[model samples]
Target: MTASDARRPVQLEIAVQDAAGARIAFEAGADRVELCQALAETGGLTPSAGAVEAVLAVAGRAERLAVLVRPRPGGYVYDADEIAVVAADVREVVRRGAGAVVVGALDAAGGIDTEALSRWIDAAAGAEVVFHRAIDTLSAPVDAIDQLVALGIRRVLTSGGATRSIDGLGTVEALVRGSAGRVQIMPGGGVRVEDVPAFVSSGADAVHLSARRSSGDTAPSGPGGGASGFDVTDGAIVAAARAALDEATSGS
Candidate 1:
């Protein structure tokens, strides 16, 4: 571990889909909120301008807001026209008051699409940038992390190229050691409240989780099954995760 890792405070970043979930996450002690839409359908699609505005309205002074800039749901790879769309979305989110933006892209070679990523970062207008989990799709995540750092990305949300952080703890640890404070390695993907302490102990500077639970209500049959009743952020789960992180960091 680097000397700085000993002093870095652990952060909890929550993913929320709408104004209601954003408010819940903030109130429950989330340090940052990743705002997106269609999380249930799309892994997380770019929220509308109005949704971004609403989330910003509810964000606390100390809370950081990051909007997801994915133009589509199928893949991280995008063409020139799609890159243009992502650039425009970055501008819109920053102008609407997001403090950061989460984005990612891949080349046909299954590597970081530096050209596309650069354009999105440029369009952020100085907002903090986070390379999203698409990094997991790369053949070499450790190398990709270095490239992202060279690009001035502040953080990268990943699960160590696995389906879950816990399943890839070794890779996550290597990333932490490899980073040596150059970039923040945030463990995400199926990170549960029970997993916070282990993630903290594993050298994650911060952790990202949705803390989501289904509403348990079924919608009538319709297009896309009438929206699947949507999953919302669970404030209690967020609170528990925060407490766990505090305990782990304090003890360390």
Candidate 2:
């Protein structure tokens, strides 16, 4: 870590699905909000331009807005058409006043798809570009950090090759040591409020989570008429995470 980075407090980035979530994150004192759609269904696909505008309106002059640019809900690998669609989406989102764009693409060999990344970066038109958790799908996540840094990626959100950031603490720490302040390393995916301290101590630049709670309102659906609830950003959880991050990074 650089001297400046060391003195800076760890950041909290919340993955939000809508304007309400963005408002909650802002009110809870989060450093940034990653806006996406179908978060509960598809692990976060790209949100609509209207959605981005609404969130930006809510974000206003406070929170930083980073829009997720995943074109579809499957793996990171994408065909030419999908890549083009992703690039277009990136352009649209950046045009809509997003401060950053979150994206990920992998080659069939399970490595970074530099080709697709270049297109998306070009489409970003100098807006901050963040590599999402798809880095965890690589065999050499630590090594991929070097590649992303080389590609001018501003930050990478990863779980250190594990499904949960807590389980991947070792790899996360290793990535931090290897980053050398060139690119930001953020541990995300299954991050809980109680795990904030451990991540803060890992020397990560930031921590990402979806401090979400189900809105217990059920709807009458076909087939399986089970009581299904939708997920929303929980203000209480965001506050707790903000407090935990503050307490953990206090003595720095």
Question: Which window of ten consecutive residues has the lowest lDDT sum in model 1?
Answer: 1-10
Estimate, for each residue in 112-209, the C-alpha lDDT of model 2 and write its tens digit.
Answer: 99999999999999999999989888878898878898888999998988888999999999999999889999999999999988888788999999
Screening candidate 2 with a backbone cut-off below 3 angstroms (N, C-alpha, C), the clashing residue pairs are none
Model 2 has an lDDT value of 0.89
Model 1 Cα lDDT, one tens digit per residue, 85-125:
99999998898789989999999888899999889889998
Query: How many collisions between residues are there in candidate 2?
Result: 0
Q: Model 1 lDDT vs. the true structure?
A: 0.86
Poorest stretch of ten by lDDT in candidate 2:
1-10
Q: Which stretches of candidate 2 lie over 4 Å from their true place?
A: 1-7, 61-63, 221-227
